[model samples]
Target chain A: MSDPAAVPPLLDARNIACQRGGRMIFAGVTLTIGAGQSLLVRGPNGAGKSSLLRVLGGLIPCLHGTIDRHAPIALADEHLALDPDNRLEQALAFWARMDGVDRERLDFALHHFRLRELADIPVRMLSTGQRKRAILARTMASGARLWLLDEPGNGLDAASLRGLGDAMAAHLAAGGGIIAASHFDLSHQFGTVVELDRR
Target chain B: MTRWFLPLVRRDLRLAWQGGGLWMPVVFLLLVASLYPFAVGPDARLLAATGGGMLWIAALLAALLPVERLIAPDRDSGIFDQLLMRGISDEMIALVKLIAHWLGFGPPLMLALLPAAALLKLDGAAIMRLELGLLIGTPALAALGVLTASLVAGLRGAGALAGLLILPLAVPILIFGAGSLHPGSGAALKFLSAISLLLVAITPIAAGAALRAGRE
Candidate 1:
């Protein structure tokens, strides 16, 4: 268990609303995630699952409400969030540098994610699962307190899924938090589940 | 820090270099210039007089072609959103991208212009002037191109929109780039320099603001 008195809530979203293409996608969505807590958002396609993630990640504006972050946040949208033309190592290095992660941690992350051999390969050549592993490598390497992941499990195999679970557990154990939106059955691992109704 | 800037630049440059074969704009620029003599009836003087303008236009078009791809790949792959989440300011990302574009397209296009200049029968002084003007002016064009690129990065039909948005803003550079090869070369050169410097100073702010707006 985390010391709630010592660690603040990683994210606080109040009354958040999102509209896309002149239509209300979701409204009045509110949630809070604290250290050692993991929240999963489940909904049908186009239920604004990705929109909510974007809002929480600060990639898009929420039509209403405030999202406050207690620490740096890392988001992995449906997009791999990497430069496809760049080599895996180079791409992750750039992310690590941007997130202020030290070189040692980055190396450890690459090894942990089983990407050490393919580090020099351009991302375009990597398979979907490899690419997702690279993206996951970046998120874990980022060392951020709040993680906003959209469809994080899309390309993972069983082993990689276990790795993802392990990463989440480690992050939460270290006073980090996760807010992931997925269609998969992640309820057994996550601490809380928020279901969004179709708009 | 300066250290961060160098690595970013180096990595981007390497990627751009490896992907050099994918540059269709350079091929298009050469092909268009090669066709000009045939289209204009082999009039050396006329070609010489018009060559700088033609090359500048071609360079602008070619430079603009890749701007969308520059940011789109990052945006599509989710690296862009991650960058923002990591707390690197939008301005830095924009500036780094602009630098990468300049290094990737600007110098090679300038080199390719020599062959185009020869085919157009450009005199020595005119070639010197064209090269110098493009050297300074292209960076400014690239800077503005990046600004427009960031704005329309994820928008539909962004290629045409990029042309529309940047061409109007690039008028000053085009005017001076072409004018610098004429009789008023000295004055035009100064104007080009001033514009380049001004753009260098202001482009980051515009790109930074646009990036922030897009993120929001």
Candidate 2:
């Protein structure tokens, strides 16, 4: 890992607070994740883990906070965000094109996630676990510097879960950062852990 | 913007075609135009005098057929959020959607007008004028459709609300487009294009704001 003092943090959020439907969800939250580091967020049901990830991804605004994002981010949430009518390869390629990554990177992402065999199938035809794998493959293919994953382990089988762990390890080793909100044990070490509880 | 613009437009156009319901608007426009002559007992002179305006009304209503599908599906499926994350502005998305929506429905409606004109007993001159009026007016109607769609995207029963929001705002386009069908009404066509231009220009900003407001 690189020296923390030498490089600026990839994400620097301070005094963050969020609310939904006129009620405070979480507040006074602060965290930082630098290159080659990770942050794992955990909370019970309705505890705002997903909301925090959304806020961090810039999908929703924080009620009170300052977020300084120094690099591009890829987000994987419950919504697959892929075109259902498109083949898995085409769906992922759309994002790859939008992200300006070359075809080689997309091929590597597909191979990394073991999605090569399922590339020709329509996205809607994938099973629950395969769908989760596809979503992860999209994140990997984005070539983003930071990844924000929400409940990424929901439907993955043991092997797929292991693949996810390996992918996360590779991402961090290559100077990418991660902030994941998950209930299942991801089997990866996180440099910082944040626990959010409902008030 | 250039990097993703063409790809987004192409993706949307492919989906619009692949979705397979584009024929609904074209069929609906023809149905309404065909039914008009039946409702008014066939009188060639009467048909010629009023057929062009009736077609304009049918075209306006035809534009509404595709409104519900314009923004709701993409927004619900999180496509908008994903696009926004890619640094594509809400205005650009709205603009692309407007273009895609128009391309999907505009030309087909024009083609269907041919058979509908034959049914209405319209002369060759009136047919040409009506065609020209619709060519300029459909873009504005499409803008209205997309604008209302964005405003009511997340609401329950958005179709009904879309009609309510669009018909009132569409009066200007309708008046100019229909008025242009009258004899020697030279300025009406210019007015029609001006309104169409204004609507097309403002739709992106208005609809973009609505999309942002829906997020909250």
Candidate 3:
């Protein structure tokens, strides 16, 4: 087995700052996560946790920071991101194709999220927790090395929440990393936690 | 990167077709062209003289029909963020969407123009000129539509605002395209082509910037 220390961190961010509409969000934030690890970001509403995730995902520009990403990333924010008109399986498959992942992985992700039976349903018909599961399935199917989740536990049931913990543990065991933002407790304990204060 | 181009275009085309986005504008164009005769009391010479210009105007308005559908839904649904996360640049997304938007409306509008021209009593020569002008001009109209859609994508009342934004930017193309049908206006065709090419070239970059700005 390769020395875990020798593998560079999956994400290396330093002095990261973000702002919106010319207002400062947060500044002087720094964190790093290596393979087989996870980081949890905790904060109240409007504390910029989602914006920070967006910055880390490169979806939005950071006002001041240097970030080095060593692997591909997947994000599951509040946005469902699935095509409303497409069947669940097809919608997930579209992203799988985009990520260069194969059919087997998509099937595995569907089963992983307990969405196999719901695969034929149109995405628009999915209830809130089911939609959240679909988003997580999309992230899982992406085969990316890092996962960025925003409010991942919002609508999950007790059993599904436990399944989420199992999935995170399995991902970490497989050398994938996670950065999730949520005030509620998830199944797995993160290696590190950073709490953001409202500015 | 190149591999994604066709699939994205195909997806967009499918959506446009399924959503009735492809045919609505064609129907709108035909309806407007057919109405011109009733409003003007069909004198053959008058129809022939004004028909080409009326079609150009109708085509411009038709381009506006699907503006609200172009980027707003995808933006609202986080499709843009997902694509961006996959390392697809915003410019590529805009370009693909521009191509798809054109494919959806431009050809159908031209085909619709055939019957519309017949309704307007245009001669064979005039019909050919109108078709040629539209072939050159419709791409610019599509680009303008995509650009405006990107600019106003997340705003309330985006459809009305998109129409307002696209019309003024489209004046040059309209003037040149409509003027090309005038007798001995070969230079007008060249000007139309130039402006069309310019809009197509810049739309992806401009719309891409608009999308990134919208994130903030």
Candidate 4:
């Protein structure tokens, strides 16, 4: 237990196959991500990148095979999933409360994501880039061990991207792992890369 | 580990209030009840006789007013996916939503009944029976509406389909509730309550399964 290197994978998927609206998007996918490690999922559009993440997050059933998740998961997808009518802090607070997060983590996440200044603004009032940042802030404060990031880098500015990188680094340093589906180059290195080729 | 259900319920209530969901049904019920006296030409005896049934019909239709918005908006917005990721099951979500929906319209509908009864010239006894029937029957109405909303949340023609789906399931409550006012049918209230209890119990499971099936 003393050596983090001795830790086993926090997430292990064995031969996962999933279908979306009667099409088998991906098949025979296997991947393992351990504590303090990250997996990069790369594929062209319509290559089942989002589907694979959904399967991993248990939003949809796996058409075949199995998934073993040793810890809780936080997923950030194309949808910011925040109520547009609510203020930025209120919208995030709804999710934070659901995740059983406290005020301190919420403040920390807002600071790290550079959203503290915009906290009082309505979500619908934010720019697309800022809204995405709000979503990332929710994900960071979720206290989940596995982060499933779907196109996390989309709409992020260079500075915000670097901040995301630092957040990922800190998360990994604390024994959490990330599985991200992204077309953009990630600032943090990954221990494993999974390419889901278009069929 | 998720305490989000209460927040979810509170948010839904707040949204419903702001969105006019809370008042739409009440006004709709009032309009339907008020128009009935003119249709029957204001014969006090006949109006009292038929007004109770008219009120029941208005309640049923009013229960349906918000079905189109109940669960579809959240599902379409991918909020359900976020909830599932947090280890909260769809069953719990459906249950919370059902409660929120009932709170949104049920009491308001009961309060609307007072004005509706007066417009129909319902006698004192008829008014008492009507109010009690609504108290027992509105929960069943809410359950059916929520259940139908979950069933057709994402499908084409969902609004019409929900109306079609709910009417048949709701027939038992309708019959028993309206029958409670009839002569020599004191037992109708008990049957109405029994049906309401059954629907309330089944909603969480039925709606939860529908949501899971939708993910396919």
TM per candidate comes to 0.85, 0.96, 0.98, 0.96
Q: CAPRI band of model 1?
A: medium
lDDT of 1 by residue, A1-199 (tens): 3565775578889999988767998898889998889999999987888889888887778888898888888887656666677688987887787666798889988888899999899877999888788878888888888888778888888888888888888889998899999987852388889999897
Report lDDT (Cα) of residue B14, candidate 4: 95
Query: What's the DockQ for every one of the candidates?
Result: 0.55, 0.68, 0.81, 0.75
Instruction: Give RMSD (Å) of candidate 4 vs. truth.
Output: 1.7
Interface alpha-carbon RMSD, every candidate? 2.7, 1.4, 1.1, 1.5
DockQ of 2: 0.68
Check candidate 2 and list the clashing pairs. none
Candidate 1, B45-132: lDDT as tens digits = 8988888799888888887777776766665656566666766577888889888888888888888888888888988888888889
Q: TM-score of the A chain in candidate 1?
A: 0.93
Model 4 error, position B202 (Å): 1.4
lDDT accuracy of residue A197 in candidate 3: 93
TM-score of chain A of each: 0.93, 0.96, 0.96, 0.95
lDDT of 4 at A59: 87
Off by more than 4 A, model 2: A1-6
Q: Give the TM-score (vs. native) of candidate 3.
A: 0.98
Off by over 4 Å in 4: A2-8
Report the lDDT of model 4 for residue A197.
90
Ranked candidates (DockQ, high to low) = 3, 4, 2, 1
C-alpha lDDT (0 to 100) for residue B209 of candidate 1 = 82
Evaluate residue A69 in candidate 4 and report its C-alpha lDDT on the 0 to 100 scale: 88
Per-residue lDDT for A127-163 in model 4, tens only?
9889789888999999998899988888999999999
**Residue A105 CA error for candidate 4 (Å)?**
0.9
